[model samples]
Target: MSRTSRVLYLIVCASPRARRIGELVGRAQARGWTVCVIPTPQALKFIDRPTLEEQTGFPVRSEYKQWDITNPLPPPDAMLACPATCNTGNKWVYGLADTLALALLTEAIGLGLPLVVAPALNSAQAVYPAFDRSVTALREMGVTVLYGPGVYGPGPPGSGGRPYDWELPLEALQEKVVRPERRK
Candidate 1:
């Protein structure tokens, strides 16, 4: 096992690709990384909550826990926001912590954690200048924003697009996360 003690938080958004996020969890676990799922409020409808809990052995959270309560999940070494919708991307860029997912992402950036974002949006939405600016800003802050043909390209005009590979985020995660062997 490699880095079994480490944690990876997979923040899901309200996109069709989010339904298949379980695949990423399995891949992360195979790499001996504990996977924690934190979906956006609207993302709750896209994921299989109980099944994910069964697979990861941790509750899937969509909101902040009650105050004064100890955190149930361990701190994450890295974070990936897959199926990150246009709204999520824009909000995150603006430092909007309206949802648990965005809040986690904002904090992760400030903490300098390895972060990856694979956004799913149509060509129409992706064309918005704000989207490009957001992506650039996130990348400038050391976040790996995966948004290309194979990762998260724009779809058709009106319809919301799907991601080429749901596993790309995990692939990005592997390449970016600091490994035990690389520790100073």
Candidate 2:
């Protein structure tokens, strides 16, 4: 499918960066993607639900819809988890779908949808062995995980450093996932 017709599920996690997700949504729309915002339950507190809903023209969904209800968002042609917190990342690797966001991510892996994850955490969190293992496991599962060096590296604990470069995940998706699909 052409990029203009593609649907992208932009999953936001419970990080300070979640506050700036509107910027990412705007950028994705500018690139012709029909973007949908899915935030983790905790991320709800960080983001402006009304603004994002208006921005995307879709409800900001954090929980599963009732069985009788129809899904409001389109099926994703691709998925991105930006500011993917250590908690969510690890849970996803283990196939823990306790939340709607995790359920979608876990299902996306099985569906073989083009997926990219940019982890956001402090150096202390990154240092854990589980973090390294999660990154490796996700990559082995054919998920594009943008971490370390030029992509993104965790800052020190309590540093509250510069905001995450939100565009990195979108850029990666365009190059690694979207562009290749176009050639087919």
Candidate 3:
């Protein structure tokens, strides 16, 4: 497939790292993806909407459009939820679609679209049993979850830990999802 034909839905969740989503957008674009930014409602506060909209050339969609209006962004060829929060992950596991971001993610699973999730949370939340279950469940459903010791180690509570390496998700998508699909 040509590079222009690949559309990537980049979901940014409510995390401190969301502030740097523009960097990820640039990287994905350079990698040949036509990117779209889907920010969780709370993520709006962390991100600069105008900057993201300008970067992606599509409005940062946090809410659903009106019934009569069409969605401006094209359908996703793949998706990556970077800095995914525990709340969103757990909600996704249970098939929650309250928010536009979650709605797209839940539907993506059934649509069989390539999906990747890189969760960002503190050590305290990381230890929660539900988080582990959600991660395992998502992986079982064919989602690439970049978590655990080597991928992303959670820091102590209140300690923000080191900045997350956004390249991890991009690389995982290229290697595990996009390339494999292209070969088919």
Root-mean-square deviation (CA) per prediction? 3.4, 3.0, 2.8
lDDT of 2 at 27: 92
Per-residue error (Å), model 1, residue 157: 5.0
Q: Candidate 3 on 1-184: residue-level lDDT in tens?
A: 2345589999999888888889999999998899999999998989999988888788889999999999888899889998799999999999989999999999998888888899989989988899999998998888988887787888887665357677889998887563645311
Give the TM-score comparing model 1 with the true structure, all chains together: 0.89
Query: Where's the lowest-lDDT run of ten residues in candidate 2?
Result: 175-184
Off by over 4 Å in 2: 1-4, 179-184
List model 2 lDDT by residue over 1-184, tens digit each: 2344789999999888888889999999998888889999999988999999999888889999999999988889889998799999999999999999999999988888889998889999998999999998998887888897877888888754367676788888887564645311
Model 1 scores a C-alpha lDDT of 0.83
> How do all the candidates rank in terms of lDDT, highest first?
3, 2, 1
Write down the lDDT of every candidate, Cα atoms only: 0.83, 0.86, 0.87
Worst 10 residues of 1 by lDDT: 175-184
Model 2 root-mean-square deviation: 3.0
Stretches of model 1 off by over 4 angstroms after superposition: 1-4, 149-151, 157-163, 178-184
After superposition on all CA atoms, how large is the RMSD of candidate 3?
Answer: 2.8
